[model samples]
Target chain A: MRDKVVTAAEALAEVRDGALVAFNFWGPGTPLHLMRALQERGVKDLTICTNNYTLRADVLREQGAVDAAILLPQTRKIIVAFSGVQQEDSSASVEIARRVQEGTLEIENVSHGLFIERLHAGAMHLGGIYSPIGIGTSLENGKEKRVINGVEYLFQEPIVPDLGLINAAKADTLGNLVCHGTARAANPVIAMASRYTVAEVFEVVEPGGLDPDTIVIPASFVDRIVRIPDDDPYSRERRVEQTLRSVKYRLEKMAEAEAEAAQGGGA
Target chain B: MKEKLTEELVAMRAAKELVPGDYCNLGIGIPLNCAAYAAEGVLLESENGVLGYGPVHDRESLDENIERVDWDIADAGMRYLEYVPGMSFFDMLTSFAMIRSGRLISILGGLQVSEKGDAAIHSTSKDDIASKIGGSMDLSWGAKRLIVTMTHCSKDGSPKIVRELTMPVTTRGRVNLIVTDMAVIEVTSSGLVLKEFAPGWTPEEIQEQTEATLTIAPDVREMEF
Candidate 1:
């Protein structure tokens, strides 16, 4: 098997301007190293397709670290399942909100299932999928529609991404990937759908060391593997600790503000 | 009948629809409260890719070391309920496959539901740039049964159970049952049926709050906890 190990910069170098990139934004599967490298590369007009575009604010608030470095000014469009704030007092990513207002960023909100199915269509080399999910919603505004069995269904075309940046728990020399726990999210499907797939793993082992049954993605689907360094701040344990500390800090700050308010009210 | 039911009572009433061994998806908001009231053997599924979840863990009650074993924390770092045996996690494709294949019953919250069983839950009129659809459209279209739980009226005193949805429709003709603070209604081929009302609420009172004309069931009774 051909060796797939490469530096994160080398792997990210393959991406160019105006490329459609499919990414896994869920939990441990977020490819933080590649994302930072992409940010450093400063590619423009990239369309990011993912489940949620609020990863930047979520991570910053929860972990006090930045994993969604891709949510920068260079991103011209986003096809996501969820976007914007839901509650009156709650807030979304300020940058994203500002971009949308300035007409610099375009967003298409699809349901989570349709988002995955569109990727599945690309992976399967099929034309598109027919589903009734968005038949009557704004999601169906410009999409092709067909009536089958007297029920209307929307025709969602395949989203063939130019690059797939995914994360995995372990990878063999040949780039066969295995994900631990819930980190296996969108990585498997996005890896198959993109023209070039780069994987960032916590550990890289010799070929055949990974159990055959444990491999979630095969070498054929992966073009490169970038092993994250041991001391990386994005490491699972470190991120968790940082997140807990940030939570405690925020709570303490809130308590202090409350105490100050009480003192003023008493005076 | 009682004047108005509590949110927990509304969820508890909705839980009565779940049968043992049923695979279910509970949306955020009031539908999430159904987890605590669900009957035994009803497996709960989360759209972020978890199945067979138990009741959500109380932050104060969680024993980090012991409870962490069976629980799977979501990507957002929110701890889900303890996991039941046979629980599994997969990628988004597999999770959504179960939803699109109609293998799970979906319980969701809605902004408005029309008499024709159409539901509008995703975006409000004020949201212009990003609609924030989430998984509501998928869950509405794909689930075997789509049960909606929400307050009967919006905070502005407008009815949510209406003759025609004023909000953007998430999915048309998908809602099966609606459990609200005021009443429990079923969407039938004939139209919206008022099956039961809160303890202090009469069928006439619920009708006054509802925008749609309701056909009170012949066997209608006061909601039981």
Candidate 2:
């Protein structure tokens, strides 16, 4: 069998223009290292699916942006479950809002549960699943709804992406992945659903270094692995900055709103 | 009139609804604070894939001991959480499976709730690209019990509990209970029933603040801690 571990560039070499890429981007599941490499690759007209669009815009407001979403200029649309601005005008978007206005971007809103279930179906090769989660909401729009056992359920379609960018805590030589803590989000599912999955791991060890019982993504599902260095700035330093910025913005916004409310009450 | 219920008080009142051994999930904003005031027995689930977590580290608490904040153990909201004895984490599939399968109860913040039990938590405008509908759509049906904790009115003094929701709906006709700043209302098969009110407010005053006409419960009394 071919070596599972490879350089980041080699692992991401197949990613081309117009590729359908999926990312495990919720909280610590984000494949930040690989996402940055892809952005530098300058791919275009791509359709990417992810959980959130930059975690409340802290990543997007900066010129560097964050995640693969920094590929906004080259990208065509984002199929996201949660993509929105925290503040309508200020601090939220210097990039996303412009794309929506130009008709260059489209947002496909979905329920969080059904979104993953759709991917679950994709990974398992199932036709679809009947869901009642968003039955009477906007998510029911343009979807086939059927009654099962006297309860209304909508049909959720499976989505298989061309490439998957996922993060795991560790990977062995055999390509098995171990994603610990809350970081174990959609990574395993993305590995199974995408045609070719690339994992960004903190470390790569010998085959037996990872406990077989704890491996979340098996070798057959993961195509390649790229280990992010322990001292990588993307791992901790950057998030600390982002978190501080987010906290400061939130506090300032709260203060402004409180001041406005006080003025209104006094009058 | 007495002091209006702060966000903390609204959360405290919602915390009263949590029972021992009940698996609960809280939305962002006012509902997230319920964890601080809630009893320890209830198992909390975060939608970004955590189950049976202990109290989360807040900015105020972390200000004293900043080292307690583990960036890796954060929820989807980026809040660092504490791990309890039997705390376990799973992928989003298992997380939502537990949610949609009615294994967890969801307490969420809201912008508007209709008399007919429709809730609009995510966005006020249907076409607003600036707001997101994260898991509220799924959380609305987490279980037979969906409790909404929010301010009685918007910051601009507009009534949020209304005859019909003018905002984008998260889910329709499924809100079971609403704990607001001024009143604790229940959604009965018949209509919205006002069960309790804050100390300085009467059912009449609460109704005045609400756009929807409220049916006062027979045993309606001042809200208790």
Candidate 3:
């Protein structure tokens, strides 16, 4: 299958004003090439949805491309709980937290667990997903709550985005993409949940090149492919970059800790 | 390695322990220094991506504009930091899970290790009034083997080696070895066995700093580099 091969910057041409753009990066498999392109284009007032607010702060902040966002409540810097890690504060999540607190940015909170189920439902083209992920608590606001199997579940609507930015280890002309072990976290889910998906790969190969069993994302859903340079070892430099990215994040935590202390140590 | 903090880092170079394929997380403080002393082959996984980052460039070389991570640069021998394009907070959290899920082979840091190996890192919970658990919950709970590198006690002559935890905990019963400036204490079911002590310090001097009990080896030798 013949396909168009463009730089990540070019694929971002589809992004329009007020568009709800979603990124598929989960930290390790970020589509930085495409993010760079969007930064270069200088798009404005984007409505972004993702698992976290990190990429928007690190990349999109340069272009003022994001005005509002939909993300897991825990993805914000001062979160109480999130997927896998349980309850913890994230420096990357703090950047968005600062913006939200300053009123410079607007955010919509989704619980981490419900966020995944909603995206999964969207990928499956389901109308809605019902789960006990967020029920009977403050997160139940404005949502239809019902009892099923003697358990309470919240009716979470499907999440669909106008554009999806993704990263992959390799891709074929047919759009089949493969990711490294840990890099595959959310890219496939984000790919299926978006209308226009652009993939940035470490290597671009032929259509029949990738193994069928190893294909993490099928080309049928992808709209574009871009290449990003993989020059550095996954070592201290990455840690440094992570460090720089989290300075603001750590400061936010210190501030939160101070605030929490002032409030008599109650969450 | 020299006795000085920066010089002891030199020992990390000679020890040549961190392997190339290993996915390691450096705790804050001295362990962060380990990144600079890390052996050539290791891949240090930060909570964020952009691996192989050198230590911060000279202030003159810095952009002088944007805020950067505290220890955001590596040394000259350090490789170029690769940015794992598009990775997000959730992604790092998952990477941390990989650590918490027993995926990481080894973790290095310093601590007040309870006899059960429960690490109290957030704070003593009595001093400064406020203490919160960060990623320490995952790090101490995860990691195949936990290495605590620090002095054996607090500044006010308080022992880090305790029978029970009195402060907020990062993890419970996760410590494997305690690498201190004075000695290497291994936590056993009975209690802490002082495996080695600093060249100039004695078991009694070491105990003076600790509030808990200490057992000295009959043939104590200098700490291995």
Per model, kept true contacts as a fraction are 0.65, 0.68, 0.03
Candidate 1 C-alpha lDDT tens digits along A104-219: 88888778888888999999999988878888788888888999999898888898899998999899999899986677778899999999999999899998899999899998
| Regions of model 1 farther than 4 Å from truth | A55-64, A67-70, A85-92, A245-267, B1-3, B55-77, B81-83
Judged by DockQ, which candidate is best? Answer: 2
Compose the digit string of candidate 3's lDDT tens values, residues B57-116: 433323343344223222211222333443222233345446556655444554577777
Model 2, span A162-231: residue lDDT tens: 9899999889988899987899888888899999999988878997898889988899999999887666
Candidate 2's residue-wise lDDT over B10-128, tens digit each? 89999999889899998999988898887878988898889888777765445455566666677778777876698888999988888887777889999999999999998888767
Return the TM-score for candidate 3, rounded to 2 decimals: 0.50
> Candidate 1 vs candidate 3: which has greater lDDT?
1
Model 1 residue B215 CA deviation (Å) reads: 0.8
DockQ-based ranking: 2, 1, 3
Q: In model 1, what lDDT does residue B176 have?
A: 94
Superior by DockQ: candidate 2 or candidate 3:
2
Which residue pairs in candidate 1 have backbone atoms (N, alpha carbon, C) closer than 3 angstroms, thus clashing?
B1-B199, B1-B200, B2-B199, B2-B200
Clashing pairs in 2: A85-B130
Q: lDDT for model 2, on a 0 to 1 scale?
A: 0.82
Interface RMSD of candidate number 1: 3.1
Off by over 4 Å in 2: A55-65, A86-94, A236-267, B60-68
